[model samples]
Target: MNQAPLPSYAPLAEVVRSGMREGVHYGAVVGLSAEGEVAYARGPVHDAMFPRSSAKPFQALAALRAGAPLEGTSLAIAAGSHGGEDFHAAETERILAAAGLTAEALRCPPAVPGGAAARKAFLAAGRSPERRYMNCSGKHAGMLAACVAQGWSTDDYLDPEHPLQVLVREATEDMCGERIAHTAVDGCGAPQLAVSLVGLARGIQGMRLSPEGSSERTIIEAMSAHPEYVSGTDRIDTELMTRMPGLVSKIGADGVLVLNVPTGETVAVKISDGDAEERARVLVGLTALRGLGVDVAPVKEHLTTPIQGGGRTVGEVRGL
Candidate 1:
């Protein structure tokens, strides 16, 4: 196994147990000032990193710009990394139905639901995983709908040179205010763009600050208004959006998260040791919010990660 070279990343969070330092999470997490400058950077802010599902909002915006008739929860699902709950699946299905398509059209691989409870219930009911239950089906569905609406080829919609992808690239560059340095296949089979941590922060900020009727604003509003569709019941995105009204929040796979407040404060975090641990990423995001004077009093319980020991209480991981 190859470990990341030292010095490229600084300590962004720590994993402790029983008053001992068990591990350290090295990564880049940044807070963007209102002027679009990097005010605080824990690591290399401009290093090219995949935005993962964090790119969904802008991708959904691209689909909207292409004339996909997404609105309300439909729009939210399009931009969400849903927990694969029943309602999430229903909305995703609705998008495909409206596109004159069905689950067989989804190219993303089949998988169990992202939510633990949903997966348990699905398995208990003697069902197998399906594409519609995949966490990113909503994103893929939205892209298909856009291709159909624009008369573009839905089969090759994920292709980088496809018409829909061309618009997606344009939308990302336009909103992030930075040229995407590279493109790669996302876990869900969509094209993911590489941009700086600060770029991600600035991009999400645009969602909040863009004109009310613009595509960016529409997606942000939908994500905020229907937080449950954006993620699921009690998930981080849904919980945070509900607690912090007017916040546009999204979490991507492999320890990626972006938080944006209505007041224009924005944060983006990437765990340099990607997939090191899922428990610490949200804590880091909340800590970054504290840097911007956003008091997370309502979410005080989330500030620490509880370490379980044989089903008993143990130590926890807390943001530095």
Candidate 2:
């Protein structure tokens, strides 16, 4: 294995202390094409980073390629880090049922809902967290479906040595148009592939620009068409796709965000400290898109987060 140097990140955004006029945080951004074209960039585009859940789209695409019978909301949820709302859980169940499986088959750990209201409702109902309520349940369900479809074993599907995992790794590398430099277990226990920020951008750009009828296109269309299934209400990924036409976005753990617009533009942002304070990833992402001559003004305000202090709006965190 070839070892790569740590990413040399440049400032992509700044968080200022309200009314104090001082920066508190810094991050990096990268914009590129599958063809290795650098459309716009900041920080280190060549260094490897864990894409986390942002890789869900590609993982879903791989499942589709593996003959998973996913469509509509099921397909969208497969590519989502959903809020585990009722609808989200139902959709996940639907996918598992389609595969002749059950929630017990999911390898990811059980967790409360990602949406605050849903979590509260769950606890109020005297219910405990279950695998179905895991935010990654949808993704795991889809993986199970793919296994069933391909006659692969449901047991140990999350293992890196599984055939399904091999397909996922291949699909990820293929889409990124680069080799995986490192691999680790993701939060949900799936294999996490590390690639350059430029590579991440390239992967999304490929999905956005893929020809009609391609699995890549299918994943992109499903996600864009059902943004609500992707992340639930009020989430940045859901809101961005819903409010912006011809746009697909996904948020990963540890402050990673990826966006692709219809015009073949792609952007990826990574906060050095993995702090998603005030939705900084989305703010910086929109800012990067704006720099690429994309008109994000319509949703700019929605993405710009208000910085508060003393229980009042003190300032704002705008893209740098």
Candidate 3:
């Protein structure tokens, strides 16, 4: 637990500028470090509430490390996902089968995949909608498999009181280096935890430092190795991993972004007012990572600053 150096940037000015953004006033905390020490911390480092989808890497890893027997597309789908294509659907089925389960066993809501093309394809193919097609279904399937491996009951698996959740909480704390201070329901009808930016950064660092075959490490590797499954082609997470070597990133609902660089730098950002349009999470995250010495050329090249009507630049966004 190395103490972070005081940020050279003035927090008062930073918060004020962020608050003035057109969409919503945003609050963020970023952590950057190498080895086991914290190099910098900004904004409110604690008390940020974010859903758990961003933490899916750790959850999926728990199943892999426990020897649930998944690999190839199945492993890729488990680690990285937005649930939009045939490959994703097939992989979800594969994981379910490997666990001696079926689509019926999934507790996630039934829906077509995320992208418009994926949904159109599903309808055109006359494939009846099933829970397995849901993007988060792969994650849920992986969790259930982990529970099965440990001989935990499959019923009420999504319950906050479930033993699997207890394990998840422990693993999450281990990765973030802090206990979850708040809890809520996720869009997938599963438990979500609230964590600080500092905690999220610590978690990313933990994932990078975690041992091979350890659940946390396994997930970080899988997602890093198969970024496309985590999101789709042209998706932020997918593109970031594809373009930036040795970096893994994920975005949560409500303008949340987390990034881990190969140099062991970790960053967590939350748009305070939750602006869906300004994409303040990406803007600030890319800016911060660039400042911390991440190779941001590709990001700037692929993700350009937006130009306004007068041919003046309004805002900029870095690619994945």
Pairs with steric clashes in candidate 1: none
Question: What TM-score quantifies how close candidate 1 is to the native fold?
Answer: 0.95
Go through the candidates in order and give the C-alpha RMSD of each one to the true structure.
Answer: 2.2, 2.0, 5.7
TM-score for all predictions? 0.95, 0.95, 0.84
Q: In terms of lDDT, which candidate is strongest? A: 1
Candidate 2, 195-239: lDDT as tens digits: 877888888888878898888888889999999899988577888
Tens digit of per-residue lDDT, candidate 1, span 1-320: 88444438778778777788898888889987666667767888788788898889989989999999999999999999899899988998999999899999999889888887998899999999899999899988999999999898877888999998889999989888899988889988888898888888988888788898988888998999999999988588899899988887898877789988877788999887774457877888888888877787877777777887889767888887
Better of 1 and 2 by lDDT: 1
Please give the TM-score that candidate 2 achieves against the real structure: 0.95
- Residue 105 error for model 3, in Å? 0.7
- RMSD in angstroms between candidate 2 and the native structure over all alpha carbons: 2.0
* Backbone clashes, candidate 3: 9
lDDT of 3 by residue, 110-227 (tens): 8887766787778988877778778788788887787778788887888988877777777778777788877788888778887777787888788888776765666677777888
lDDT of each: 0.86, 0.85, 0.70
What lDDT does model 2 reach?
Answer: 0.85
